[model samples]
Target chain A: MLFVPGNNPGMLLNADVYGADALILDLEDAVAPAEKDAARVLVRNALSACGYQGCEIIVRINPLGSGYTGEDISAIVPLRPDMLMPTKVSDAGAIREVSRMMAEAERESGLAEGTVGLLPLIETAAGVERAYEIAAADPRVKAIFLGAEDLSSDLQAIRSKPGGEIAYARGRMVMAARAAGVDVYDTPFTDVNDEEGLRQDAELARALGFTGKAVISPRHVEAVNQAFTPGEGEIRYAREVMDAIEEGKRLGRGAVSLRGKMIDKPIVDRALRVLETARALGLGGAEHE
Target chain B: MSKLVEGIAEAVRRSGLKDGMTVSFHHHLRNGDYVLNMVLEEAARQGIRGLTVQASSLFDAHLPLIDHMKSGVVTGLETDYMSGGIGREISRGVLGQPVIFRSHGGRPEAIESGRVHIDVAFIAAPAADPLGNANGVAGPAACGSLGYAMSDAKCADTVVLVTDHIEEYPLIPASIGEEDVDIVARVDSIGDPGGIVSGTTRITRDPVGLAIARYAAQVIEASGLCREGFSFQTGAGGASLAVTQYLKPIMKRLGVTGSFGLGGITGYMVDMLEEGYFRSLLDVQCFDLRAVQSIRDNPRHFEVSATRYAGPHAKSAAVDSLDVVVLGATEIDTDFNVNVHTDSNGYIIGGSGGHSDTAAGAKLAMIVAPLYRARLPIVVDRVLTRSTPGKTVDVLVTQRGIAVNPLRGDLEEKLRAFGLPVVDIHELKERAERVTGKPETVRPGGRVVARVEYRDGSIIDEIRSTEE
Candidate 1:
């Protein structure tokens, strides 16, 4: 995902060309208080005008207490974004409040209930403690996002390049989202110029079992995607695992072994997921084998 | 006994430059050039009128020519390319006669064929001897190759060598020989060294540009032309130059050594030559100081004249041997005819420099540009000006998708088989339109302002005045 300032028409129009899986058009922190109304109108118009083909469009609205959230919800729900990322979400109550406003907007706009999903940003200490509840707040809650900057501030902790400060929050959010059967996204690396650092950070996020990572700059999108994508060696091994399982089934054997390693149910599921991702990304695989 | 003249005015007086005569100059100094303004200002002071100026290219530094045109000191214009400073005036129909725009190859061909005559050609020699032997090296404004001036020197009835640095009696390995120079003059400064060559050339960091570059490199690799002895050319635009960076790793993995790199030489091309990615570089102009240093020190980095570079009538040119070339377009129609001359709003901004020459000669001509720039679709229903005809252009690479010319169905099959994204040209246009809503077409209904001449000296299209 890439974050494009909602007020910038130039970046908003060209956001999909950067090859990001999703675009977060930000009307929260990116827009100044003076430009909130203007950005809201611009983003609402852009969502209606641009198809944003093949990419998920998520509008990051202001927090529920910001006074502008109600208007943001009312204006954007008509355009039917894939999701609305409510910022500064602390607990299940905040997610419910935003969902309530969204339901009202849906009724007014004649859109079916739950047409627009919610991705609550868990950026506070309370949010981290109640992440599971927030993820399972309502059926409208699809995923939870880690906003490390605000979470660190809430903890009164100093952020560092190594990101030891947010390690606990990161782990807790992933486990929480998994328990609730929803996807969790890692926070963006704030340093745009440090490609090596960004790659390492993204790899760390993937290792922590996060589904995807958000990028603040367009240039980081490719690096983050590459970090999340399974390599060719992994794809080849996955293909072999599936092949061994099929061969074992054809022979009526109760167990399957590939190159001296037993292929179990969990291993087979991981392999299937790898092959599915590789196929979706159009990567080369050992299909012939 | 010395052939050195006093100053520019003396050289102009000695060249017998009178009313209605054509004077020529080269643009090796680029935007830093002071010689064009110096010579034209002296001529204007001498009451010269109705003179036609034939130049290799005009930059913003020559904005003084607008005043000359207004005063009737200079009335006609012919050039390979015109930067927007003067191009804007021409677009407003500032001159009585329409400007004649020629390709870099076509300009020399026209001069050689006597189709366009020159009365006096003022050569901006960075270093010259009293006897008028000149070279671009060993001077304050060392702008590597003096290729464009060679044609004018040989064909002009009178040739004047203007220089800031005067060497010994005989300059060894002179780019402009003594026999071709009629008069030599000394100046305080010919051009700013800082402006003569860029400090360094870097690949674009723009994601869109990088994506297009990646796709173009993949196309070149899949074209089966990346084998031994491949030769190629690319423009100096950010996206076009980035193609070289992508091709570097591909060639390394494939163990392919290209024959030569052609056109304006940059530091990247120098690095490629140093690294053995290419055997040599055919330099017409140096785009940066690193290229200037390389051409001066490296024996394999050779300089070629404009006629030898891309002249259509030449027995053989470097462009003819090119395997692939990456170019840029302002807009391209479904038919693939490209427009680099005018912006989408019908304003004169750029002209064809080597766009047509390399496209006609290369095996695979690829255009690298974004699908839409600044809310305007680049793939349009029709190009505002046909700079390079679609028949010669083979591919268009954009961030959205790659479109191969329908004429090259075999190429489409190869690209698709390689798992590259290939879309029809019309579909590409529609894809662009979906993002940027259909723009109101800009039609210039005013009188003709400039005529675009192809490499063969045929009029391909005419740019009209934007003013009503």
Candidate 2:
């Protein structure tokens, strides 16, 4: 996932070219509150002007509590993005309210009732606490993401270097999303200059069970992609595992060994999954899909 | 003091039968490398024992050389890089002494310093005269620049030029001159041109890779280093080339020209030079066809011995003179340490190459990669192995966000000021761990398969045989 400022036409136009599975046109943190209206207009125009190819475009509108939320929804409903990202979602009530507003906006805009889905951003202390409830609130919610900066600020917690302070919240968001049977994504890492740090954080998020992450800069996406991709050694090992399993099955053996390493049906199954995921992401080889 | 012979067997005999002698070959052929096995087969026929094989780099096609290593005909080895077959064998501890690996620049230094004196240098050229004047750009086997063989020809006591095409007397525009040639022999085919171009070294079309390359190019441009007289180095990969291609427009638009470029010079570098992007090219090795022609025709395309490329003690290493270097990776840890040697399964498929030397030498070392490859994370809590120490790696660029090592705090501040997406490395690792599940530790057998040596010749990490 890569974030493009909703107000920046250049960024929004180039978002699909960055290989982000999902492009979040952010109207929340990326854009100043004063530019909220302008950002919505720019985002809506961008969606209407250019086809996003196959990229999942999600417009992250301001919180429902904000006055511009209704306007933002109304402006974007006509353009029809794949999903709407509602920021600072505190509870299930907020999601339900946003879904209804989106429905109303769609109706008024002459669009289909379920034209756009919802991806909630759990930012506040209350949001993290009610993550599971918020994720399960509306069927329209496809994923839930944790916003570390806002959560840290709301909790009055010290923002640790490298985000060690917010590790618990990030993990909780993953568990909540998984329990709710929806994908989870980590928040945008603010320091784009620290490429290694961004990579480390993304790796941590991947390990913590987030399906993907929200990236604030183009530089971060490659590391995020690499952190998620399998290495050549892993692919070779996976192939070996599959080969051994096939041989084992042919010999009526439940398990076998290759290069002295044990290979069972479960191991083969995991290997197949790795290959499948790699192919799905267009990352089976060194080249991008 | 006698003239060398023509056949591989004759060359081996003329070099004198001995239990141990160092023989060297170059990797100008890349995967098309065929000289090593041919020479080893002759040595085996003569019952040569304890032969120390020195190569510029080893590829999968050189796997047949392993039989000689196991048979005690070749008991030692030295090279700048080892990948695929040779890498697996070394990682399995099939050889007696640990293979000594050097950077592309360091290999020549070792030879010149008498640390690794070569007894004989067997060069495989595409075309050569009987007197040993040879060129790689004019034959069916044309692989490219003999940048790597230049050092061996100068430092080795004896030099043998093996070619598939023996041109007329005094082959004009010689890449390796007569002064370095002791003998020239004809072979069926010096190398397969098809194999030379097997790997893609063009710009990446993948959106994520392209974005990282662009951002890296941006960082280079923003650093105020993409101007006239700036020198740069790029790894031999598609994305690195993409970074170069991305920088071309920016450089052209700014009217910023460079004095020189460096690293594994390819056609892309040649094009840049011919187009007046750079005044000169410091080529340590030719990676493709165009570079060979450039080296032959363009006097400005100067060839430098490996010693001058990244030798720690060279007066001024080529890498040391680089403004920026874009590299690839298999895994990078949060501490900023990079692993290009071992894989997630703890098997080896990568080599040291110039990874550490460039990281430690270049003004800006940017590692470009996607966030995830094949479900397994490329950024780990701890890299399976460390080839380039994190201290030397300056910036990490990905499609998601950029992370600058804290050591470059000022640069980080500058990028942040530009409104770039800067994040801490630890945060990135945490996020990855959160999704992938923490990596479980794997116990290895007691035997050590490979030992990763830092540029300073210190052991940084060791890979043990996988426990079954």
Best by DockQ: 1
The list of candidate 2 runs beyond 4 A from truth reads A1-289, B1-4, B198-200
Candidate 2 C-alpha lDDT tens digits along A138-244 = 88989998888888999899886578778889878888988999999888777867877888887888777788888877767777888877667777777777767
DockQ values for all predictions?
A: 0.49, 0.15
- Candidate number of the best TM-score: 1
lDDT of 1 at B365: 97
Per-candidate TM-score against the hidden true structure? 0.93, 0.64
Residue-level lDDT of model 2, residues B1-468, one tens digit each, is 534355777776776646788999998888887788898888898888899988988888899888998889999887767776677777667876766666665677677778788988889988888788887777887765677788788888888888888778788778788888887766677677877753335655555678778888888876667777888888767577788888888889999888888878877888899998999998877777677667877899987766677778777878888889999888898888998877776767777788888889988888987656655556777788788999899888876678899999977887787666787887766544543556775545647766665666677877776533
TM-score of chain B of 1: 0.99
* Error of model 2, residue A156, in angstroms: 62
* Superposed model 1: Cα runs more than 4 Å off: A107-112, A236-269, A286-288, B418-421, B430-437
Best lDDT goes to which candidate?
1
Candidate 1 chain B: minimum summed lDDT over ten consecutive residues — where? B428-437
lDDT of each: 0.92, 0.79
